[model samples]
Target: AQSVTQLDSQVPVFEEAPVELRCNYSSSVSVYLFWYVQYPNQGLQLLLKYLSGSTLVKGINGFEAEFNKSQTSFHLRKPSVHISDTAEYFCAVHYSGTYKYIFGTGTRLKVLA
Candidate 1:
């Protein structure tokens, strides 16, 4: 079974600061990487994905991630983050054939005013 690991459980940053949320995965076969965000009590929203072709994938809310196959990592980053960006970020990987999703523990981003 595939799995994802979010290196940071929580991240605290001031408004307008840069942030990076680390994500790593382990899989035996080809996989699809995804980044999703969840606001308080809200459903998860797709942020970005890496199905194929590009290594660097751009996502919503000024977020982006680079899929490094060699490292099995897809770290999310934002050049400048706002208070509204505060949310729980999850890294998920889907098995190409099974279509089953394996999600990371989650990284909580707390933006301070």
Candidate 2:
């Protein structure tokens, strides 16, 4: 069984500063991972994904993630962040040769001035 772990439950950063949200998953037969962001009172929106090819994947809102096969990690990064960027981030993984999905708890990003 594989599980996803978001290292930080809450991250507080100053506006315009760079940030990196860490995510790690246990190794499995095949790796299908995704990153999603949720604004207040809104559902999750796809941020980026890693199905195959290219370890580095870019997504909307200037967000990107790099899949490290050796580390079993898909850490999200942003050169700079805005106050509007404050939201809950999540990661989903499909592993263990099953159709079932493993959803991450969430990593709350609090962008301060």
Candidate 3:
């Protein structure tokens, strides 16, 4: 079975500082990954994704991730963050023929001032 792991349960970073949320996945076949953010009381929204092509991919709100095939990881990063960025971030993996995503436990990014 395929699985994803978010190493951190909570990542508290000061407002306007840099942050990185780790995501590691394991699969037997080819896989794609995605990063989704869910604000308080809201459903998850797509933050970024890794499908094919370049290792580095960018997304909305100044976020980006690099897919490392050898490491089987796709880690999201932001050079700076705002208080509004505080939310629960999830890492999901989709195998070649799967229709659904396998998500990690998620990491709550707390942007403190």
TM-score of each: 0.95, 0.96, 0.96
TM-score of 2: 0.96
Model 3: weakest 10-residue lDDT segment is: 24-33
lDDT of 2 by residue, 4-105 (tens): 999899999999999999999988768899999999999989999999999999999999999999899999999999999999999889884688878888
Tens digits of per-residue lDDT for model 3, 25-93? 984478988999999999999998888899999999999999999899999999999999999999999
Q: Which stretches of candidate 2 lie over 4 Å from their true place?
A: none
lDDT value for model 3? 0.94
How do the candidates rank by lDDT, highest first? 3, 2, 1
Could you give candidate 1's per-residue lDDT for residues 1-113 as a string of tens digits? 47789989999999998999999998557889999999999999999999999899999989999999889899999999999999999999987777579999999999999
C-alpha RMSD for every candidate: 1.0, 1.0, 0.9
What is the C-alpha local distance difference test score of each model? 0.92, 0.93, 0.94
